[model samples]
Target chain A: MRQSTFNNKFLPYILLLPTMFILVVFLFYPAIETFRLSFFKVHPWTGATRFAGFYNFIKIFSNPEYLHSFVLSAMFAFAVIGLGLFFSLLIAILLNQKIAGIRFYRTFLIWPYALSPAIAGALFNFLFNPANGVLCYFTGYRSWLTDGRTAILVVIIAAVWKNLGYNVIFYLTALRNVPQAALESASIDGAGAIKRFFYITFAFLSPTSFFLFVMNTTYAYFATFGLIDVLTEGGPAGSTRILIYHLYKDFFVHSKTGYAAAESLVLFTLVVGITFLQFQTSEKKVHYQ
Target chain B: MKQVKMAVMMLIITVVLPFAVFANGGVDVDESATASIEFWHAMSGERIDLIQSFVDKFVAENPNIAVDVQYTGSYNDTLNKVKSAYKAGNAPDVFHSYEIGTLGLINSGIISPLDEMADKYKKDIPWNDFFTPVQSYYKYQGSHYSMPFNSSTPLVYYNKTFFEEAGLDPENPPKTYKGIREAALKLRAAGHETPVTWNLHSWYFEEMICLQDEPFVNSDNGRGSELPTKVAFNSAAGQKVLEWWVGMEKEGLFLDVGPGWANHRAAFGSGEAAIIMSSSSDVNRLTAALAEKGWEMGTGYIPRPEGAKGGVAIGGGSLWMTNNHSNEEELAALKLISFISEDESQIAWHKGTGYFPVRKTAMDQLKKEGWFEENPNYLTAFNQLLDSPESLNTAGGLLGIFPEARELIQSAIQEMYAGKPVKKALDEAAAKANASIEEWNDIMQ
Candidate 1:
């Protein structure tokens, strides 16, 4: 790439102004304020604030419910990612074949990606309602959603189903880019299809997998807020209550603004830590052409 | 550099466009001889059309006032929207909030108390004519904070035909916890899969506390000079209520349909449940639902313990006037609300939806016309309140954190159902509620 010189020295700075302005106004400002407010106590409705350094953090950390939600969210993210990636990759490889009506099938399969989480939650809620749910009637377990033990599985299924389209799109593109020559040459050495997929195709798709891992992790953490809120409101003995749902209840429903802000900080730190770890692992494992 | 700027602009659009689309674009009101007031409500379904019709009549009556009525979502959504809108200085002239929000709104310092506004406007609103329970429930610190709109108490609805088949008198419905349990078992034994169910709610628990003639929280059920410091529902009355409830669930006599107002209704309508406890406001819908199956439905007082002394506390929303409006706008808003509380409006509202009339004159008129005689189910709820002795508990607990407290109690009930001891669950709920109350009290101070 060639470096171009600006006709006017100040032109480049002027061009950067809008982006900087938005970044400060929307992102940096709230991020900084959230950090500051986490140390205070805030009234939800009144927006009144009082400085109580470390008090909010101490209260939440000591809360057993918060710890339970933390573990539940970690597990939920893991299940969503594991099931989501594996199924998407399998579907992507199938779609990579030359099948008749491929475009129609692909469009039908990928349509859920266009749906927001709220829509997915509502759809699942209608299907799993204990009274007259279609799926519950078929399954003969009306308490699929009302039972605390089974409701988490229902939520996980909804989350994975909603994200499947997004994951498949990436996987399909990555599958297409796997070197055909390497596969054919390996086949000449009597390598089975599964062996080739594990050796060459999988290695070539490592970077895409890593990118999706991070994206799915973030999605499980934040995007499922609406799903949990509409489907359960974190109910049935709080079985399906994830960390984001807890933060929403504290911030929006309960109006404990300072406590919610503290929760936000905790969530941000978790995400950042996970991303940092992902970077350290990606450098060694991810392949770049 | 040009390309980079364009890319950044695109990123900003992608990020900010959803907010822009979601931003409320309603017109801002101004003070003039033609006063335009915004009236936001939480009523949906057919009630939206009913409210609009009422507002249309009001607008016709007063040519100078133009009232804008918008149906915001549920009670929670409306309150949250009002809070954000209030902060942004776009608060509606008048808005609806559920009954439990009375203390929270009073202390928020953002609402104009209805009594003060009535006095300011010199309007002759017959506050005395409002049904006693409805009038007193919204009163805090000896002042009326909001105008009662759709007030209701939970009522027990039973399938009359099923009762007869089970060899129980259709005319005589259960009135005590023991009576209800016996009736439920008989109904189930008679081959009704589920005998009774109600949408899971803390309102029922709170009402049971009131029926036992006990305060729900300290400091006079949070109605005294000092706000509530801790909840008192972990007492014997609370335990008795939960034990009876959980026992029924265990016996499979009562259907544990879980939380929300819809599931239990559907269960009952489909004949999967023979009896359902729900808001008196549901009389119309439940009756019609049973009629669809060619069955007659009956209503009875919500069952209680044998010797409980108190009565039902009202649920449902009320209309609140917001602060920061000019005197003209406030007066116009007050006129709109007072019009809603008038006997004519109350009668129509009571008939259209089965929420009991809020005014005594409406009840008198309905009685004179033999309205209750023809539709006796409506009388069950009104009589339930009329017979209730007034006490701090029956007046409904006044706490700034009542919403959160209700949620805590609800989760506790679920915990009990899922195998935790009733006392243990209630105690845990009380402790959590007290923690929230203390934090709320601290912030208020």
Candidate 2:
């Protein structure tokens, strides 16, 4: 009995040993090293390393550019996610109608997510070209990348466009999963289309909407990083400077690996804190009945 | 369970034994016939074709030796790849590096010291024949780390049509700071919306450094034991340059045509902008692209303020050998480097890439062959940079952590362009740059 118990207790760990080893090799070790390095100042170009005590972090916090990058990152995340959810929800409701070509509409809505972000950024760069861009033709604006206010809008538009399809698919699936009987019962009670959706359909889709809120927030902050890096490079004048862009510049461009690590850790913490806060605030409002 | 354990052990043994055997077998591999060297470089465009042809000829001539060349993205990307590969114990035998910040690589022992090899090959290399400024950019702590590869000097490229339209002499481009402003005003009057496009920010500032006779950093851009300290770019000369840019902005003549040389060149090439400051290496490609467009282009030496030093630094990359190789592999790599530095190879590279020849012998050959008479733009960089034979700044600054320093300078410039107070941007950049240099100094200590 003892032998069987011992075998049973150790077997799970034995089964998990490979995954643990892989994680240690790839993720855990790098994270630990990055944490250690955040306490040091080193020249990235020369590979010469030395220990520093919180100086890198202190410098990161003290620098105005780094601070600006953090604020911009948060703003970009919310703007992209909020705008994306609002539009995707609207599209979901429209497609939910028994309109002709409804199946075709759903497929078309999910198509943008199939393309790579790099390709998307490149295409948008061409479209926003000052001299010969399609948008430039309409707006009569030269040098779209440099204009401060418009540059931010351009990045948000690209972010929203790239993510619209994925959110639509998510919301559409949730809308379909909502109990038809609940929606029908509301309509049978002399409720109009708009009334039925707000009262019955919205409550049923709340869980999925909440789940998408968390997901869209994460995607907006992280996945759009490479797109921005390739596109404007946070430039014209850093009008579009974001957190991941700052981290990349600090690490690869500036060669301040330690400072970059500290910035990344702080960014990760902020993301986690915000996510937890969102969960705490919204968990009570979501209904499962 | 026993069978599974045995099979797992067998798999582990199978995986480990071959690597051990391969390591042991390396000593017995063929050495006398010829050692094949793997060289990774970042040169692309027409230059890639030029290098491929040269390597093909070299392989045909020296059947015993074979060279495998790989394209490794931009200079910055190549630097990162090489450094990471070195740490992982898998660097290529040879790679490309630039002058300014790469000296840090040598100091950190990522690259092999080429002082002894340079001495041994000094006569063959015609080291004295190389322009002194170009050579200065490659040496670290009085020791050369790599052969001078594609070398260029910063110069002015102007649209001839715009100059003519502005009632300015197309033959005479700006030769002084006052002249540039006057010409810009004329171009603006001629209906060019943006009269001046100052791309390659370093070129304009490096010229300003020369004009001011001010240093790029503390202790002569890190030539001595002094730390980099703060960036000195916000000096009177730097502010003057920034004010000049701001003045142009006010006049509606200044435009940021993207951050890179290619973008600015494209803007001007496409007729959106009038003048751009760039390396002479841009001439051939620009000429070829503009040839079909039927627009005349003009080339001139970079303008300087009156009574300012006028020598420009070299701006292209060099071939650096990594320490992650055997002695034999390094020697083979050196042979390839030596081959590329020969007259025929250098001339081919010059004609192909618009980069000036690094050797007097190659230049002499090209001159005799009528390359200059046929393509005068190719000679502009050589003539302007080699004008002074003994100037230290002419050789280019070799800061310990040069790329980072450039980044600091770029960030400061970006801030200034973004409308930050010039003084504040420069001061902040200087402080941050000093912190980085101090960190590098600490590591060296």
Q: Write the per-residue lDDT of candidate 1 for residues A1-289, one digit (tens) a residue.
A: 9998779989889999999999999999999989999999876665667899999999999999999999999999999999999999999988999989999989988998899999998899899988888898898887888788888998999999999999999999999999899999999999998999999899999989999999999999999988887778788888989999999888777888888899999999998899889999787988986
Q: After superposition, how far is residue B101 of candidate 1 from its true place, in Å?
A: 0.8
Please give, for residues B266-333, the per-residue lDDT of candidate 1 as tens digits. 99899989988899999889999999999999999988899888888887889999999987899899
TM-score of each: 0.92, 0.88
**Cα error of candidate 2 at position B396, Å:** 2.0
Q: What DockQ does each listed candidate score?
A: 0.42, 0.22
A84 in model 2: Cα distance from truth in Å? 1.3
iRMSD computed for candidate 2: 3.1
Residue A59 of model 2 has an lDDT of: 84
- The fraction of reference interface contacts (C-alpha pairs within 8 A across chains A and B) present in each candidate is 0.52, 0.23
RMSD vs true structure, all candidates: 13.1, 12.0
In candidate 2, stretches whose alpha carbon ends up further than 4 angstroms from where it belongs are A1-24, A41-53, A100-107, B1-34, B64-66, B118-124
- Candidates in order have lDDT scores of 0.88, 0.75
Candidate 1 lDDT at A121 equals 89
lDDT of 1 at B131: 81
DockQ of 2: 0.22
